[model samples]
Target: MSKGLTRRSMIAGSAASVLAAPALAQELPDTVQIRESLSSTTRRNTASFRAIQWRAHFPNLRNGAILVDIDSRALHLWQEDGGYHVYPSSVPQSAEMTRKGRTRVVRKVVGPTWRPTPNMRRRNPEWPAVVEPGPNNPLGTHALYLSWTYYRIHGTHDTRKIGRRSSSGCIGLYNEHIAEVFGMTKIGTQVLLI
Candidate 1:
């Protein structure tokens, strides 16, 4: 055999061995045929699985709507009737404003600006009056502002803060997760904060 052919075959064999070990470790049953079929296509399958799980978990909501259960720390997206998804979230410290109300979505802005509110300014006098949206902004890549309130359900710069009591008063979610919700939601969609 040619030297190049031998090298290619060795690399291919090594790659196959590495890929096969994980499958051997799991030893999945035949009943897990769906997982087996998706083994090579995990990302798309996972996204779809999560989307279906969200719909099943939050069945009472209508399509193009959402229910943000702060107490449960979950965001539910209602796509088309009975179609939707859920994502874990981080909300404001209940000890702070302790607000518990609902409002309609006013807008969804990607890479939203972070303007310090009067209260924010008071709390941190050194904070900039207006911080343009970017990686450094407290609001991450997406911000879904609500009607009749200064509050927003937006992505957070501090991603690790998700699933915790971290924000000043606004709802915080993972950047990518908020982006998913942003696409499914629209202006005037009801956002119940309970």
Candidate 2:
């Protein structure tokens, strides 16, 4: 074996900083790298799965569509090769998550501050009125605002809540996963909440 960087090194080093892409390595975020598989590992059991066995042949959506599959609790970033990027998500209750229409990405922000909605405040008056951008913020690292009223796709401080019905009404992802999606998605991107 040689002492130089090899293809195997890059794949194995995906999680660590030793793939040795020196200059470009500095630009890599500490966030989780994109999954080469369609499924995800649950933080709860580590060994257990969330049944995200999707193949990403987006039935109706095209390559550019962002499909948030509530049933699968997985978000698929439609790709040109019929293989999509999968991100685990914590969806709102079925009734609350279904917007019954197509919406477009309205705004995108990094390190978004989270201000409790009036409804959220009414539900929990003791909750803080606002949370500044930080590791503790409800909207972790980044957010993608939807055209629909108060709905958004954002990161969460608690990754354990992902792959379940945990969010008030918006979709939630692990901070790292949200970072990947936020970077790939752009304004005017079609969002189907179904």
lDDT of each: 0.65, 0.68
Q: Candidate 1: give the clashing pairs.
A: 111-141
Off by over 4 Å in 2: 1-63, 79-83
Off by over 4 Å in 1: 1-63
Clash pairs for candidate 2: none
- lDDT of model 1, residue 110: 86
Each model's TM-score, in the order given? 0.66, 0.67
Clash count list over all predictions: 1, 0
Query: Whose TM-score is greatest here?
Result: 2
Q: Please state the error at residue 184 of candidate 1 in Å.
A: 0.4
Best candidate according to lDDT: 2
User: Where does candidate 1 have its weakest 10-residue lDDT segment?
Assistant: 29-38
lDDT of residue 104 for candidate 1: 77
Per-residue lDDT of candidate 1, residues 1-194 (tens digit): 77667743664555456445553243222111112222233323223222223333433454366666666565666665544456667777765654666577888798899997898799899999888988889889999998856788888767667666777888887787788788888787776666
Output the lDDT of residue 23, model 2. Answer: 33
Give Cα distance to truth, residue 89, candidate 1, Å. 0.8
